[model samples]
Target: MDLFWRYGFATLPVLVFVSFYRMGDVLTLTLSHPLWNARGYSLEAISMADGAVALFASMAGVAIGGWIAARWRMGWALVIGALASAIGNWVFAWLWDTPLADGSLYLAAGIDQFGHGLAGAVFVVYLSMLVNPRYPAAQYAFLSGFAFLLPRLVAGASGTIQKVIGYDGFFVMSGALSLAAVILLPVVLRARSRPSDQPEPAA
Candidate 1:
């Protein structure tokens, strides 16, 4: 508690963003249902696109995310990662309306997985950045656990949300929700500086 406040990460906006960060990402679930039942895609095709292609795409994203975390401001990385994920969700919605061209399905799956990897990598780094240097293990455990706690619990409501909105609307909302993280970025960045960069008081 003392450390959280001293580090400037205990505020409502930061807490809210951390808790809900996974909401938009997870909404991209149920991929096989639409692909297999509605689109008539084969298991092999699904396996190829989601399993193999997605693995490579996600790896690429993770690599890029790592580079960005190393070089760039993490706030910008958050923006990039979140937008990629949100756009990935919207891509699925758009493709569902249009007849999927050959390879389009694979492309959509790849984008989603890539965004997942990017955002996930960036988020992990961000959490680590917030951990108190003196109490790395314990603080990180609390933060990491709290981060996913709400998102996982609220995940059950997704099916209900989908039932009401249908796929396209659901996906669009998912995209917008992810953008919420982007919107919160300024607040988070302003509230908390990196531990190493912790501002010193006037002499």
Candidate 2:
């Protein structure tokens, strides 16, 4: 279990990637305020978009994300997923100004939900790969839990940040959080190309 955190930290960038992998997802936490209070989007609009539209859209995203990873590699899926989440936040920011009757709300909701679905599928697979078959449960818990650690902490301040900067600024800030993944991608990819710290081989 400690390997995920304790492995050769100096040489391996895995810890950094692991920590920042889903950082942009915190944006989802900030969404309710802008959509509900700031924008006055109705619960009916929320249901219409998050219910049927999200169901199909998220399903499609998961399928496509899986296909992309299969066709090229897992990294591509991760990169795309990170970008999707960031872009989704930006769309929501823009949607804040859109009139609800214009149906733009549905489009923004679909994009955000689809991104979550896509990111979630690949992220689970990636986390599983990082686990040891010997102690999969504990190791996976650490990695998965660690991935959200910083995001959850940062999310504590989300409301304050939004109030100070306004909805659009807050959304953009959330989208900008993707820079963590983007900036670290090269190092993470390089680390992947090399041998990863893994479970000891069976005798």
Candidate 3:
């Protein structure tokens, strides 16, 4: 109904953040093999670095992010995640050709995986807060669907974008995309924090 759509519309900023965030994620993930090959890395080395190390780092990040969000504000946690993701992407792209490039790549990949874990945890929290408690299941299902829906569509073009820009440029673009979430976070937080108006009790 219109109400459902309107409720979804109220969370437009979050949706925008999700779209940009996931698009960048998809781009990085989709092109990682090609990027590693270009960097003269063997498949086994790439698997060891990006697979095992990144996985463990991501688990740590998820735990740390969840702890921080529990201790501080979720909005601030999301900000931190965005900053980490952006910086990680920048590092990966910038250090791709310098000395110790393999080490640099591992470090950047770990940082990026951490950022992803953090952001993912915080995103679920955001959805929980946004959904109506009375209809938790239905509302969450609707909103959660909306969260990844547009992002999937936008991420479909990552191949074309990567082809046009190359790996370094693509990574930088991914980092740059996170800025939209940074700019919009404060607005979304403020809107979410506002209290609904209630009629005063009769004397």
Candidate 4:
């Protein structure tokens, strides 16, 4: 269990990098496209607002998700998080083709941010529950390394992918990947239900 947890955490940077890269590329492409671009807004302004909103929303979601994880089942949280992530990605993708006024873009940005924020919060809580306090030093080191390295590696090709596949395709692919995380939830829940030397609470 510990090994599995460590490996997962260690790969997190890669996952995040891929996710963010896809997100940024899709956003840029969508907002800059002549037919899909938001009315009365510059690309830079849209990017800045979207980025800022995503950051704040993610922060808040993490705090809330952490609290929820303490009392809920980790498997359930993971499933919900996966679904939320997929939904968020879908919403962002939808924005690519949505024709709207300036204020409508703001609303769309808010919805996108909210979905991502909730997903982040639930995901953090799920991951945290997997850690064992006894081997904190080694585990933490692995997590830290992954946190810094994976994103850099995975995000590198994001721009190229966007150029090749376009915004809609990129977003659909990303959403599918995020949704795939849910497949592991049942396995995780079964593992948790087994009797252990030190039985821990769910989540």
Candidate 5:
């Protein structure tokens, strides 16, 4: 029940919201004229390339994250995902501006895609863990609602924030936020792992 509630109801919505917002932002950028110029690539070509990259990258991310989650606890998986996301964002924000070949962007895009994938997988696993088998339907519905709403609430401001900060600053901030998430993992895991009714299990 706890796992279901946490992951299914709580985490799913957040991940969905973030995914939607991220997709929208990427789409907007891919279609925008200025971004194309900034990248020294044609708008149509870049847009096409970006779309393709996002597709593959997200799929890959989800796969890897899911794999990791299956072997590890949700907290650990989330921690890893958060760290990867931070690193990817940092690279995108800082290193992306360097004069590199087109292949470089593709590689960077792949890394970002992997990060997102990992996040998605971790979220799914966590939510799954939260769902209680007894009241699966009700709990799932509750989680589903959050899955639908929170992203919009949190990610809605992303555009405005990005505008104010610019890509570099925004990436840095996002990375920092991700790191903060990572930092919380140990505390959360410790609490979760603490002995309950039964005496503490021998380590």
Candidate 6:
């Protein structure tokens, strides 16, 4: 605990990852049902868009991300996933109120799902990498626990944010927060490359 407190900045990638993941969750949870109701999309249409199109696309994206993670560094994968997520959210936000052909909503949902799928897989890998191998169990538990809790806590504010900014503005904020992950990529790569980056055993 003392060591972690002293070198907190070394945890940049994980913190950013949590933020990115939460933003995506907030966007999905806070708006999807309400948006469907406002847009007059039947529950069946919503099911198709979320359950079918998004689900399949997300699965495909995870597979692709797994392959890419094998071939490339985790940090790069994170950057790509973050950008894709941001773009996907932006696309949905842009199309929120526009008249949609039967296929358009599915496309938007698919894009968002694919981005999230990619990011989700890579995020776990990245957090694992950031933990000290010597204290793998405890460090991982700490990081993972904090990562999970903080995001959900902040996400609880989505309702309040939606009331203040409205859906479009809320979505735009989500996308923007996701993009903040991109800024930490260089730091992640730098930390990974350092000769002393190896994790030390817990005292």
Better of 1 and 3 by TM-score: 1
Candidate 3 vs candidate 6: the lDDT winner is 6
TM-score, structure 4 vs. true: 0.64
Indicate which candidate wins on lDDT. Answer: 1
**Clash statistics: count for each candidate:** 0, 0, 0, 1, 19, 0
Give all candidates' CA lDDT scores.
0.75, 0.71, 0.69, 0.53, 0.58, 0.70
lDDT of 4: 0.53
Name the runs in model 2 displaced over 4 angstroms.
1-6, 10-12, 192-203
Better of 1 and 4 by TM-score: 1
Model 5: ten consecutive residues of lowest lDDT: 24-33
What's the candidate order when arranged by decreasing TM-score? 1, 2, 3, 6, 5, 4
In candidate 2, which residue pairs clash? none
In model 3, the Cα lDDT at residue 203 comes to 83
Instruction: Return the clash pairs for model 3, or none.
Output: none
Candidate number with the higher lDDT (1 or 2)? 1
* Residue 39 lDDT in candidate 3: 76
- Judge candidate 3 at residue 174 and give its lDDT: 80
Q: For model 4, how does the per-residue alpha-carbon lDDT over 1-203 read when each residue is reduced to its tens digit?
A: 55454445434443443244224323333333332342346776577656775567657656655665666676666555556555655665666766655555555555555556665666545445444666666765664455335334544666676678876676666666666656544444444322234556578
Question: Which ranges in model 1 have alpha carbons more than 4 Å from their true place?
Answer: 8-10, 30-36, 100-102, 193-203
Over 1-203, each residue of candidate 2 has an lDDT whose tens digit, in order, gives: 34533444533466567666666666565554455545776778777877897899889888977777677677777888788878877887788766666378778778877887777777788778666566789888887888888788888888788789878787777877864576776666554322445657789
Residue runs of model 5 more than 4 Å from their true location after superposition: 1-40, 144-151, 190-203
